[model samples]
Target: MKKRFVSMLCIIAFLFVSICGRIAYIVFSNDFTVSESYNSYVLNLETLYPVIYYYNLEKLTDNRDKYAAVLRPNERTLTDLHNLFPSSQINEITNELKAGYPLVKYVDESKIGNEKYIKTFRMSDYECVQSQLISKASSGLLSYVEPCGKREMRFHIDALGRMLRGDEGEEFEESLSNIKGIRLTLDKKVEEIAYSALSDMQNGCVVIMDVKTSSILTCISKPDKSYLNKAFSQYNVGSVFKIIVAACALENDIEFYYNCSGKTTVGDTEFSCQKNHNHGFENLSDALSNSCNCYFVNLAQKLGSKKLLATADKLGFNDDIKLYDEWSFKTANLPNKEELSSKGELSLFGFGQGKLTVSPLQMCYSLCTIGNMGVKNQVRLVYSSLDENANEDIVKYKASTRVLSEETSKELLNMLRNVVENGTGKSAEDSYHKSSGKTATAQTGRYILGTEILNTWFAGVYPSENPEYAIVVMKENGKSGNEDCAPIYREIVEKLNYL
Candidate 1:
């Protein structure tokens, strides 16, 4: 009896401790959720971009593929002689047409004498709207080879699922009602152009978009059909993100002038410029053009975390972009004020380090707003979904929010132009057209023998005065943005000039 009483007492004490720990956790955590592990943010292996599609429609020609085959595979062969005669008492009728017993019979009207069935074959004979579905039932928008099947009546979808021809066949209403094509914002010509350039790349993505509209013209993820779109996948963006920090600085009217001794320390955390050498004294535009780390870090510390976060929020960071429940191009993470309590952390955040991660798409969009004279259009992937009839049921999705002011836009545009003219991103310049851009070589922390792995990046806008396009290129583990990514950007710019 004494032992039993002791056991009961211990159980009661254990329950009390558990309840107290839960309360303490809730109180101190302040209901802020620590984000999920890094791997959880990735899309699934088999997940295809459901919104990937093209806008234009071409009419499919009435030409049918001609072929020749002796008979359908299901029909009994001539070797099955027992079932040859339909009226034979010794055997039963086979499911398929008996081979030996020809169905040909004398008829009053004969074009090629007596014939049982047509001799030549055409794909149209075996193909119907239902059979056309046999090929594309598995893949959504990923396949470039397997074409969408024909509706038989008149309309036939092309290989890429773009509606080539539309005219309701005899069953136009029924066929149209059955067909649903998800329209994507991808331009066929632009996609082709981007592909031809990046085709040989082992891995990476090439993204181009309409700066004014924020509509992606081409988004081709490399490794051809990778489940994760590296173009939109978030990574430490390095100094390419300086544009955002710079914008924030300008918006807050922070002093753009500072002296750089090449290295500075914040609470024992030393930060150095790229070359570990002094840049002397410089203004904001010079710092941006030179890609000075010390200048930005000092600016970030002075601005404080609250103001920086506000700037990031205004520019769209640490936000949810609900593209799908399990799949999406999510916004990148930003440091909270509490985490920025230390000068080191704030400085790191200022220079695009310390847990900062962002998709190329997000960066492109931010630059688009700068190019769009501070107007930010919602990133649109799809124009609308349509049924076969071509009837009007357009799902219009478009909205614009001013992301920056016109004055800031003008100043920033000029600063970007300076970058191409006399900055780390000089390769982005062109002889004929004005260009503006930023280059970055982000440290990945995973080093070997004291050498660092990197994520190189380049973000640019062409025809700077009145920008038409936003272009971005990235290379994983590529050492320098200028050496690796900038040349690729130049090639793309030259190609665009041809157009």
Candidate 2:
């Protein structure tokens, strides 16, 4: 009996020792504690998206560090769930929790009060970075986040107290560390000014660019729906193409004088000036200032298709102006020489009609080239990116190219100034600043109320003598360039001068 009792005592001692050893291992072993440490670290994890800033460093989108308030379902009761979420969402939340989701988002911060658990776990509101203009220009960099309901609980121990089966925790941490925001060349105040200036128009866009740097300062597009930046969208562009025609004439040393008879016939097609009003015996400068279709038609016949197409190509027509990844000014179309075989086709193409179409952005940049004294600087939207520590990574752009000679550009500038001073773009003249530009009234072939729809445009540079800024204003279904677009251009300029 004594030996049996001793054996029972030994067996009980061994069992106790085994239990203690298991507890100590769980409490102190590195392997066992790793998951605990990871879970604790991940519980405090917050997802951040990139924020977009304006040129002056003003926030264009929401704060990047903002996090979503989340609830750990394993730690909360049904009563807690009922108080936090809508009654309709209770069942869905319960199901998600039961389906191994360790946490769910609590979006209603108003309900989170003095309750210890709620207060301790509450996070910043999950308003992801978003802005209509920023999103469009940023190439989806400032896009919408996923819906709260669909957001996965990033990291937590399961109800059974086991690490959830995934490597997303480490991957998410790495990604978060690499996430960066962008600073754009855009100025919010200027953007707002431009937007307000076009308030009266149903459809149109405005683009202002710095001629020296090719940085877009203000870009506003009307009918601003579904993230569409209409400034980059193509339109007929009307007489704006005459700039290219004039450039061709100047570069080739082609000189001509034509007596305008109000209308000129080419092949079976006849072209007429504005209202068929004759401006007799016009030179290149007079024709451009007067925007004479007859004179340009005669000039186009003289220059032919190859020279026109070459000059247009050099000015970035029929090519995309890439600004950022997957974002660009829509390709401005210029028909090939073969396509302009007919005299009528070439004549129509001469004065910015037919198969020619350009975006407000494209036209603005073309003006910038002329304003920069024939140097075509690369167009840039994003200036730099900000890292987690607020370090800047400046964006690099392609080198500027000489698209026109200084002499030709100077001649064009003089002709454009004449248009503003004494011709079609007279409305664009400001008392404070001298401006130079061309006006265009394009035929869209779309009619409203039996009247043909027109797209009017005024593209030019401000403080004309030493050009600094290039601007383009476009209005759809308008009367004429001077009557519709130039006045708005002047209004924008007047406001900008004050700033």
Per-residue C-alpha lDDT of model 1 across residues 1-499, encoded as one tens digit per residue: 9999999999999999999987676445423232222111111111111222366642112123433222221223223332222345213333343432222111122122222332222232222111111113322132332223432222222222222221111211122123245455666677667777775666677788898888877776667644556776788888988898888888878876889999988888899999896898998899989899999899888888888888778776765553312234466877678889878889988888887888887888888888998897777665665455654344454478886888888898898888888999887777665768999999888887888888898888877789888888888878788887777777777777776
Q: Give the TM-score of candidate 1.
A: 0.67
**Predicted candidate 1: what Cα RMSD to the true structure?**
24.3
The regions of model 2 sitting more than 4 angstroms off are 1-47, 63-67, 71-133, 136-179, 325-330, 448-450
TM-score of each candidate structure, all chains considered together:
0.67, 0.78
Model 1 lDDT at residue 318: 62
Error of 2 at 317 (Å): 1.9
- What's each prediction's clash count? 4, 0
- In model 1, pairs of residues that clash are 58-164, 59-164, 59-165, 147-159
